[model samples]
Target: MSSLPLTRVDFDAAATRISGKVRRTPTLEAVACKSDPAPGARLLLKLENLQPTGSFKVRGATNTVMSLSDEEKARGLITASGGNHGLGVAFGASMSGCPAVIYLPESTPSSKAAKLQEWGAEVIVHGAVWDDANEAALARAEAEGLTYIHPFADPRVVAGQGTIALEMLEDNPEIDTLVVAIGGGGLIAGVATAAKLRNPDIRIIGVEPIGAPTHHAARAAGHLVTLEKIETAAGTLAPRTSAELNFGLISAHVDELVLVSDPEMKTAAEWLWTEAGVAAELSGAAALAAIRSGGAAVEAGSCVGVIVCGAGTDGIG
Candidate 1:
């Protein structure tokens, strides 16, 4: 798993390596709701929000951190994230017996920061935004000879995320469309790669907040384009730009990208909690919001899958 596009074979290897260690989160058919789809039109939820670190990021972080060589492992690991990614690194490093250092934006929720510290990672409060925190983490990793475990932008992480789609497809072969939330685009990249490999016809739709539409902007420019400013309640999806690797994968595999409002995500989060007893943060619920807003309409009988990706929330009990 070098620095190349993640494929199904890499996903298979990752799935084998991390099998029992990670949860095979369940997929549930959507029940009729007052604000969701009309009766007789079904939806499916892949409940990755229920994962141990309360997010799908654990799958990628665990895979990437565990893939480190013994020498790399001995050197320790460093990462930067807004919240959920930091938790994943902290949790994964603990399992692999590696010392972890996490850098987070000043705006990171205290609930998420506390969770990372509780998982035994050294938490550094740095910069006002993610990019600034990332720069600090990179400098520290280089100065301290630590292995940098990126939240995204690495092949191993992408492969690990792709495995989620493989699991979901295995559970529900009839699935024709997948709605996924995009931040740095690792989750969607991996998932789109795997979904296309298994079923090229499956529609891969990426949901982004209107305020932070990295993919949409990049696609329009026909290259990875950085946004001037970030503004979103979906903090996990606030990356200023998609990486070149993620852009390539998304350009090649993802079928569509849609934008949703913060209010729409809030409604979806509340609905999921009330209807399914699932606790989802704004980023995790954005995918379902896309579908409900008719951004991802499907045939009547077709199964459409949405990833409830993460839940590192102050609201989670």
Candidate 2:
């Protein structure tokens, strides 16, 4: 495998490369609420849920799809996703006029599948978890001679995801800490790389569901290790293992890895709806959940930013 090519310069270039293709999502000061981390801490929410596909996955998917050669685009795109990434791939392929086949785990919510189809993707329901679906997608890609887009493993995908950090910091240069949700680790891998390169003093904190702490377990073991099983309300974050490239990036750039419970994420989702009028899915609310539950820390008066990475579901009420 090639060494990951993620860098501050790569991220900056990706920002320019994918400009106007992906949403330059806004960053808003978090509304004061009962779930506030610290009384005087300034919390900014990077509203990635506002992306074209309702998730930050569009950044990486669009960048990767757009970078493909004419021949590769003609060969078509294939991948597996828990939800958000599939939506992104579907959208990207549609924009690029390429056929996309997305393998989704059996547990994927129907709404996500419907959205993927709405974007003209050929959706295949396979396996019980993301890893299983991913294996099926890879096999199909090989059999069909299609280009496989690994959700969080490829360098282009990571660089594309890094664009979120670029926009966040550009919008708020004083952001001293960034809290992001981790699934296969693409978003944080990219965001941490760019954010740390931009300001080494800035802290990059990663949040994962306690039931699906793929990156957390990998960090503890000091190597990638697949979970025997995963169970979480944050289905998008239930990948059994973090990609090796993503693990290495997390080790190098991420400052902290915190686990939040499904309940905590659910409460955070509710809080976002009631307090901020933002309807965040559980995965999208994971970062805020970490802060609210004290799994991730914020110092008073510090400028903290959270990536609200997706809003694929209706209000969990």
Candidate 3:
């Protein structure tokens, strides 16, 4: 809600405000960063999967909800999420003593909807896809005069998510590349902006499920594009479309876009759990999957940062 373009300065400030409010999170250094084209590459995992909400969405939702004025907070909040975002918003709103209404597609798993409801959010099941649910949520927000908490399109949300890059780079100054999962491009765009601001030389790579390649399609067309249908097991990353503003941010800051199959992501998630003891969701493991599939190569002795973005068990193993 601040402006069209989110700045690194604002991101840092949000990080400071949410410092004690959120986990500083831990970083896992991969023993073997590369074995092929990027032999000897050093890699570290930013374990956002360990956040209080079991996902990085809390960072954005917390920041946005806390920034709301008392009047706005009293008005209640409404939003649409694939899964993780809804939980984050619900938790944040509850913390702020603000009621929340979450609109989710009927396709969303009952387990996820139950989690949101547990946080005191009134869950509404409507539509068949993320976009359709989003439209309905928007309508409810206007009709009820509730505050609309956008999942990713808002500058506040982007800045909040960008704080992850700041925290990671602050601890590992040698990082040369960042690989992140992309949904509506919120996490990737924010991370790219913050990481690039700190080190313009750092390469920002985005990974999306091959079944839901919104960012990939948008990048190809140089604009936001919507998918008629998405059929990925990675529910959190199955946004039917990419936000134009987020697409622009990613296009300018991200260096490359790669995709991984659902099966590949599932394998990556299982591998991470076994090898790193990290509980990663399907979409959360996608960045690592892309790298494993030879999507991007890190230079020898260079440090690369990978975001383990979520831990929800909705659509992933």
Candidate 4:
């Protein structure tokens, strides 16, 4: 364990390092950005769902994979993902012109596997959970001399994820609060780090699936705690463990954590589609779920930014 190298400078470097490589992502101001319209609370959406890979995962994956040396890239890349991050790694490997091998748990849906494969990755199904698959992916990386990109554990990846906050604050200097969904914690970790560094008073509220509650449990215990089982259908946001790096960042920078149920997320997703025609996955809608449910305090006319982290047809279809 190396000490986490996350800082404002690192985040700025990642922003500049992956500028045109990844979309800057647009910010949309709309009342519909909320789960339900609030009388005076304004909602702005950071539309990362519009990214090339349809998720914010690409930022970290691109920063990690592209930062690799030519020889490292030539050695190939390997990782484990349930969905979004796998697509991100595949996209990163493709950009690097390096072969990518993504390991998925047997429980992952065929549609997700197909999506990764579509990105030119060699998809391998192994074990019964993401941790099991991750172990296998690690072993393969060691045995085959492939570079392994940890979804949330790596500092570079975390720093890359923070770039979203940099862009958001730049676009809306008055954004007083940031609402983000956490899976493995990379996105929230990065965003919180950047946002807090930029403005220490900027509130960072992290949303997690009620069933998962990875960070909530960790914060309650004052250390990392792995869940015995996951009970959420939002695979992208159901990681049982939040890596030490992410835990530390969230602890230091995040103002609060909100838990949203799968049903709430689905309702929020449906609301997004109906109100703004934005197709958001359940995980992506978790932030709005917290917002409109009064999960956090929304003072009148406060400018809050919610990240639509990914795109999916889960709610509409």
Which predicted model would earn the best TM-score?
A: 2
Off by over 4 Å in 1: 1-4, 38-40, 312-317
Tens digits of per-residue lDDT for model 2, 87-162: 8888889988999999999988898999888888999999999999999999999999999999999888999999
Q: Determine which window of 10 residues in candidate 2 has minimal summed lDDT.
A: 1-10
**lDDT (Cα) of model 2:** 0.88
The reply for model 4, stretches above 4 Å from the true place, is 1-4, 33-35
lDDT of 4 by residue, 80-184 (tens): 987778888898888778999999987677887998888889999997768888989999999999989998889899999899999999989999999999888
| Model 1 root-mean-square deviation | 2.3
TM-score of each: 0.95, 0.97, 0.94, 0.95
Is 1 or 2 the stronger prediction by lDDT?
2
The Cα local distance difference test for each model comes to: 0.86, 0.88, 0.84, 0.87
| Backbone clashes, each candidate | 0, 0, 0, 1
TM-score of 2: 0.97
lDDT of 1 by residue, 65-97 (tens): 778899998899999998888888888889889
Model 3 scores a C-alpha lDDT of 0.84
Pairs of residues clashing in candidate 3 = none
Consecutive 10-residue window with the lowest summed lDDT within model 1:
32-41
